[model samples]
Every structure is written in structure tokens, then in C-alpha cells.
Target: MRIAILDVDYRSNVARAACVTAPSWATELPLATHVSDIESVQEYEPGAFYKRELPCLLRVLEQLAAKPDVIVIDGYVWLDGACRPGLGAHLYQALGNATPVVGVAKTAFHGAETCPAVVQVRRGTSARPLFVTAVGVDLAEAAGWVRGMAGLHRIPSLLAAVDQLSRSTFETPPGASAANAVAG
Candidate 1:
């Protein structure tokens, strides 16, 4: 199966989205990478974080050469048991609910323990656990996959790569940074 991991970073008025894809069997390195920059991005708003991120993510996904079976985001799918939607959830719906989404968050969300679709995962011997949530996949199964991702630290290797790729936009010519780059 092909899986894609996505992350976004904002600097000044630009928002950059980075996506890295690899076969599930080959987790050590990404098979392909894509990044897009959205200029004049909306300013951050208190309770509406998804508003800015969702569009940026969609723009990045639109530039993908192929669609992945599952897309992973750097946040929670649901904030509470009541199913409050986060960026991942909105992305899942915006994609017409065809592709499954998994969210991996570095920090715990308040009241997240009450959510049946949320799971806490610990990698290595670190006391801190990652908060994982999913849409269109079982929570335990998603967590298990995360546990298998390449990494010796708390964050998986590919995820960290994507994060770096997103932030590296600042070093590249306005929109030409990741267009010719492939991780594998």
C-alpha cells in the first residue's frame, strides 16, 4: 500500500505544505515528495485553525502525481469523543471521504482520552506518548502502523522529514524548492 504523510509550515504570509509518499513496506525512505506554497495565507485565528491549514493541505495534495491510500497529518482527527473535527477530519471530508486519514500529534489534547477513536502511543523509552487519531481506520490499527514507522525517537523518520521539507521552503526560490526533489 502507498501511504502519504503531510505537514504544513507558515512563515510571514506564506504557508508551505509538504507531502512525502512511500510504499508501506518501504518505510525507511520516501519514494516521492511534493511541496506547494500558498502565498497570502490567511492569518491565524483562535478557534478556527483548520481554516488556513485545510486549504494549504488541499493545494499540496492537488499537486501529487498519484493518490495515496492513506494520508497522515500532523494533528488529531478528533478533539473529543463528541467528534469535534480537526485538520485531519476536515481533510478527510474535503477529499470526499475516499481516502483514510491518520493524525499523529506530538502533544496530548485535553479530554482526548474520552475519544474512542484516539490512541496514545509511546515510542522508544520516552515517557511522553503521541496522541493518534484516525478517520476510516481503527484507532489501534493506526497506532500499530505508527509504531512500525522508521525512527528511533518519538517522531517517525518520514514525518520528521516532511516537517523539515515544509520548513525548508524558506530556503528555496519562491515556488521551486520541492518540485524537483524526491526523497528516495
Candidate 2:
């Protein structure tokens, strides 16, 4: 299955969102990548976390050459046992529930530990776990896919690559000043 991993990063007033697409079996590298930027993003709201990130994410998704079988977001699918919508859930809904979404969170959510849809995944002997949640797919199966992602660290290789790609857009190349650098 083709899985697209999504992540967003912000630098000043600019928000950069990136998607890395790869087949589930080939986790070593991304088959394709898309990036989108939004200027003057809405100020961060305390509770509504997806508000600022969603627009840019949607833009990146729109730029993809083809739709992915599933999307893996860098956060929770559900906030609590009540199945409160998180970023991944919102993305799933935005797509009209056409595609499955799996959330891979680096930190634990307060009540997620007990949620049947949430699984704690530990990679490469690390004691810390990445909380995995899913919509439209079995949580255990999602966790298995996450566990199989190529990596020796807490974050999967492709996910890490996506994060790096998002942040790199904001980075200034050596000898170039930030003022002259244009972020895409």
C-alpha cells in the first residue's frame, strides 16, 4: 500500500507542510515528496490545534500526483477514549473519510493509554514509546506497520525524513542570509 506521511513546521509567520509518500513494503526511502507553504498563518489557538496546520496540509495533499492509500500524520488520531477528533481525524474527515489515517505521536496523550485504538510502540530498544492511533484501519495493524517502518530510533526513517524536509525549507544555506532566502 502507498502511505503518505505528513508533517508541518513553522518559522516565523510562515508555515511549511510536507508529505512523504512511499509504499508500505519499501520503508527505507520516500517514493515522492510534496511541500506547501502558507504565509501569515492564523495565530495558534490553545485548544484548536488543527486550525493553523490544516490549510497547509490540505494544500500539500492537493499537490500530490496521486492519492495515497493511507495517510500517516505526526500526531494523535483521537484525543481521548471519547474519540475526540485530533489532527489525523480532522484530515480523515476533510478527505470525506475516503482514506485511512494513522497517527504516530511522539508523546503520550493523557487518556490515550487506555484507548483500544491507541498502541504504544517502542523501536530499537528504546524505553520511550511512540503512541500510535488509527482511523479506518485496525490499531494493531497500524502499529505493526509503524513498527516495521525503517528506523533504529524512536521516529521512523521516512517520518524523520519528512520532518527534516519540512524544517529544511526554513533553513538558510551556508553563506546565505535569512533575508535573501526564500522558503517554498
Candidate 3:
């Protein structure tokens, strides 16, 4: 199976999205996985997951019950106005090709020119850029897959749902405790 997984922080809840694909079938997500990076909200502050991403990602990777052929991660956060993390380079460094991984974002990052081809999506009549990377799957192949499935929208179906879900997850309070990130 050609599987792709998406991991992102939502209200400090680490939301995961998975899609399994084959020659004839494609399966996407069992809803989402919500994870918290800190052991307690009293110890860490809200939005800590997005701020301290390495710890957050460690928790997220642990929460993944099933492995995917490729994992796509969100890649942007700032320590200061001028010091933002490189989502693509960081994810690549973290994974080290041990497993295929890619970073996704709406905005462009510095050094993005070195990455794979970026998707120029124009669903029907609108023209806009979409995603970038050639981490696990080929860029053209991945783009074709999204173009076939993204429907009449600027964003792909899976990513659009994730974006909305992440925004909505923040509406609810993340509560009092953190997740035990140790692998089971």
C-alpha cells in the first residue's frame, strides 16, 4: 500500500490523518488522533505543542498506532519574528530517510528552492500554489493524486479537512493533563 499520514497540532491536540492507497482503492483517516505534549497544563502553557515542536512530535510519533509509507508534517513556528523553524529541513533532519517524511505549509519558507517541485493547483478556474516536497513519493505523482481527488477546491480533500479540524479543535479546551508519550 502507498500510505500517507499527516500530523499537525490542533489546540495542542496532536491530530493525525492517514490515507492508504493501492492500485484500485484509497482509504483516508479514522477521523483523527489528538495528543498533548506536556504532562500537565499547569507545567506547560497552552500552545506549547506548537512552540516546542520536537517534544510535540515525539508524542505524536508515539501516538501513531499504525505506520505509514510517508508522513507529512506541518513546518512553521517562530521563536522570534525573524527566527522561524524550517519545516521541511527540520522534518527531513528528524526522519533522516529512516522513514519517508515531508513537510507541508501554505506559506513559503527560506531554502524551499532546494526542495522538490511545488504543486501549482488550478482546480477548474482558479490558479494558486498548493503543496511542495518530493520526500517519499514523486511530486508529479502526488500532485496527480491530489488533482484527481481534491475535487473542485484549492486544497486537497484530506488537507482541507485537517485544516478545518485543527482550527475547530482549538475551540475546545485541551484540559488538565498531558499524554504519556512513551511507546507502548
Candidate 4:
């Protein structure tokens, strides 16, 4: 399956979104990579973090040549068992709920342990667990895919690549078209 791992980073007024695609969960290297820069991103809100992030993610996703079978994000899908929508959930809705989203958060949300939507996964002997949440896929299956991802550390390789890509310096100048900024 073609799985896309996505991440975003902000610098000054610009937000950079990066996507890394792999054929399988255990692949160490990406089959392709894409980056898009969004200017004047919205300010981060306390409980509405998705407002600042979802647009950037959607813009970057547009750069993909084909829709991914599944998407992995760097945050929660549901904030709690009540199914309070987070970034991933908002993304699922925005896509018409056609794509499955798996959220692998580095830190736990408050009361995440008891949340039915959340699954805590320990990897690579690290005491700190990855807080996993999902929509449109089995939580246990998502956790297994994450646990099987190619990496020696707690964070999977593709996730690390996307993170680094989002934060990396873009060669295209500010105000340049997204076409100039995207790289595969």
C-alpha cells in the first residue's frame, strides 16, 4: 500500500508542509517526498490547533500525484474517548472520510490512557510510549504498523524524514509559487 506520512513546521510567517510516501510500514526509505510552503498561516489557538495546521496539511497533500491509501500524522485523531476531533479527525472529515488517518503523537494527551480512541505503544525499549490514535482503521492494527516501522529508535524512520523535511530550509524564496518549492 502507498502510505503517506505528513508533517508541518512554521518559521516566522511561513508554514512548511512535508509528505513522505512509502510502499509499506516497514520501509526504511521513502519512495517519494514532497514539500509545500504556505504563507501567513493562522495563529495557533489553544484548543483549536487544527485550525492552524489542517490547511497546511491539505495544501501539501495536493502536491501528491495520487491519493495515499492511508495517512499518518504527528498528532492525535481524537482528543478523548468522547471523540473530540483533533487534527487527524478534522483531516478525515475534510477528505470526506475516504482516507484512513493514523495519528502517532510523541507525547500523551491528558487522560489519553483511558481513552478508547487512543493506544499507547512502546517501541525500541524506550520507556516513553508513542500515543497512537486513529480514524477509519483499527487502533490495534495502526499500532502494529507503527511498531513495525523501520527505525532503531522510538520514532519511525519515515516520520523522522518528514519532520526533518518540514523544518529544513526551503530553496524557494518567500512569495514564490508552491510549484517552485515542491520537491519529489
Candidate 5:
């Protein structure tokens, strides 16, 4: 099965999508293609941090034109907006059952329990912990894969590469400073 691991870039309109492969028996999440796009995610209220993320979500979903059987999304769907169940659920509705969708988040939900297959853990350089709430794809599969292919480094391999790629896409540094870009 062809799998794409997705992650969002806070600095730009692009989201990262890469092919996930197991290079060794124990490791998975080897990423490639690592494309980025400008999408519309304004569905969330302006005050919401993810309001601007709508564009990336749309652009990321459009990549599904290739019709990979499974799409592993970057954030766990929760709250009212952005890419959580609202967007993920909406997207799944648009794609129908023909395509299976899964959400993974760095932050967990306090008000709700969880669906089957989602996992939680800390990611990124700061290692600042957040709950990962995913709905579309099976995280049991993703975590086992993530255990190997990446470092505790600030950015996930796929997301890090995608962040770099999106900056290059516009020929810009992503922000006033590279540091700002990554931090954003």
C-alpha cells in the first residue's frame, strides 16, 4: 500500500506529503516527494491559530489526485476548526469511503476520550509535549514507523524536508529570518 505522511508548516501555505516506506523490518516512515502547496484553511475563526492553515489543508488534500489508498494527515482533528475532525471529517466526506483518512496531532484533547488507532507523544526540538489525536489513519502503524526513521530532532524528517521545500518554492526564506520560519 502507498502511504503518505503529512505535516503542516506554520510559516507558509504549504503542507508536506511524502511516501512512507520501511527501509528495515523495524523502521518505517522513510519519506519522499515531499511536496508543498498553497491551500485555504480559513474555515477556522481568525483568532484560532489554525485559521490560516486552511489553505495548506486544501492544497494537501488536492495532492490526493494521485489517489493513494491511504493518506496520513499531520494533525489530530479536535476543537472547532483548522485541520482536525472538522476539516478531516469534511475532507473524508468529500473523498468518501473510497479514500481512508487519518489524523495525528502533537496535542491531545482534554474534553474527549478518542477514537481507535490514534496515539499521543512528544515531537520536535523543544520536546514540549502535546497530545496527538488522529482519526483517519491508524497511528499504531505510524508510531511503529516513526520510532525509527526520524530523530528527536525539532522537525520530522518529512516535515523538515517539506518546510525547506516550501520556502524554496517561493524562493523566499519563509519569514523575516530562517529562525522565525522554523519557530513559526
Candidate 6:
């Protein structure tokens, strides 16, 4: 199975989106990595974080040659017990809800602990557990996938690589395409 893990980082006028593709849940390395730079990104809103992030993620996904079977994001699919849509939820909608999205958040969102669909996964001797939420997949199955991911730390290796990719700097030439592809 192909899994695409996504993340985004921002500057004053730019948003850098990174996609790390792994062959399976337990894969330690990515099969390919892609980055896209979206220009003139919206300023972050206090309670509407998805407003700034969703577009950047969508733009980067366009760089992929084919749609991934599943997508793992660095945030929540559902925000709270009330089921407010988060970034992954919005992305799921954008993709017509065909692909399952698993969200692995580094920290717990307030009130998420009360959500039955939200599961906490602890990995590798870490005291702090990762908060997991999902859409289009079973909550337990999603949590199990996360727990099985290859990593010796709290964060899975591919997740950490995507995080680092987002923060890494790169130059885009004038009038180039939004995406920059680098296969691994």
C-alpha cells in the first residue's frame, strides 16, 4: 500500500508543503518526496488554522503522479467531540472522501480526549503519546497503523522526515511551477 504523509511550514509570504511517500505503514524510508511552494499564502487565523494550510496541502498533492491510497497528515481530522472539521477533514472533502486520512498529532487538542474516534498512541518509550484521529478508516485500525510505523522515537521516521522537509529551505526560479519533485 502507498501512504502519503504531508506537512507544511510557512514564511511571511510563502507556504512550503512537503509530501513523503512510504510503501507501507511499517516502512522506515520514503519512496519519493515532493515539495511545493505556494505563493502569497493567507495569514493564519486564530481558530481557523485550516484556512491557511489546506490550500498549500492541496497544491502539493497535485504534484503527485497518482493519488495515494491513503494519506497521513500532521494534524487532526476531527478537532473535538463536537466533530469540528480540521485540516485533514477539509482535505478529505477536497478529495471527494475517496481516500482515507489518518491524522497523527504530536500534541493533544483540548477536548479531543473525549472523542471516541480519537485514539492515543504511545511509541518507543516516550511518556507523551501521539493523539490520533481519522476519517474514512476505522479508529482502532488507524491507531494500530501508527503504532506499527517504523521508528525508535515518539515520532515516526517518515513523519519526522516530512517535518524536516517542510522546514528545509529551497529556491524556486522565477515563474516556475509550484511543485518541486525529488524522488527517493
The global C-alpha lDDT for each of the candidates, from Candidate 1 onward, is 0.84, 0.82, 0.44, 0.90, 0.45, 0.90
| Stretches > 4 Å off in candidate 1 | 171-183
For model 3, the stretches where C-alpha displacement exceeds 4 angstroms are 2-4, 7-34, 37-51, 75-85, 109-117, 170-175, 178-184
lDDT of 6 by residue, 6-65 (tens): 999887778789999988999999999999987778888988999999998998899888
Error of 1 at 92 (Å): 0.5
What TM-score quantifies how close candidate 1 is to the native fold? 0.91
- Clashing residue pairs in candidate 6 are none
Q: Which ten residues in a row have the lowest lDDT in candidate 1?
A: 174-183
Poorest 10 consecutive residues of model 3 by lDDT? 16-25
Model 5 TM-score, 2 decimals: 0.53
- Model 4, 44-99: lDDT tens digits are 89999999999999998887889999999999999987999999999999999999
TM-score of 4: 0.95
At residue 77, candidate 1 shows an lDDT of 89
By summed lDDT, which 10 consecutive residues of candidate 4 come out lowest?
A: 175-184
Write the residue-wise lDDT of candidate 5 on 129-148 in tens digits.
43344444564655544433
What lDDT would candidate 6 get against the real structure?
Answer: 0.90
Over 1-184, each residue of candidate 1 has an lDDT whose tens digit, in order, gives: 9898999998877778889898982387788888887766788997678998998888888877778899999998898888889989999999999999999999877777666768888987788888999998888889999988888888888999899988873545554334334545
Weakest 10 consecutive residues of candidate 6 by summed lDDT: 170-179
In model 3, what is the error at residue 162, expressed in angstroms?
A: 1.8
Clash number by candidate, in order = 0, 0, 1, 0, 20, 0
Alpha carbon deviation, residue 169, candidate 3 (Å) = 3.8
Ranking 2 against 3 by lDDT, winner: 2
For each candidate, give its TM-score against the true structure.
0.91, 0.89, 0.57, 0.95, 0.53, 0.95
For candidate 3, write residues 79-131 as lDDT tens digits.
22233434444554566655555444555544443443455434545565555
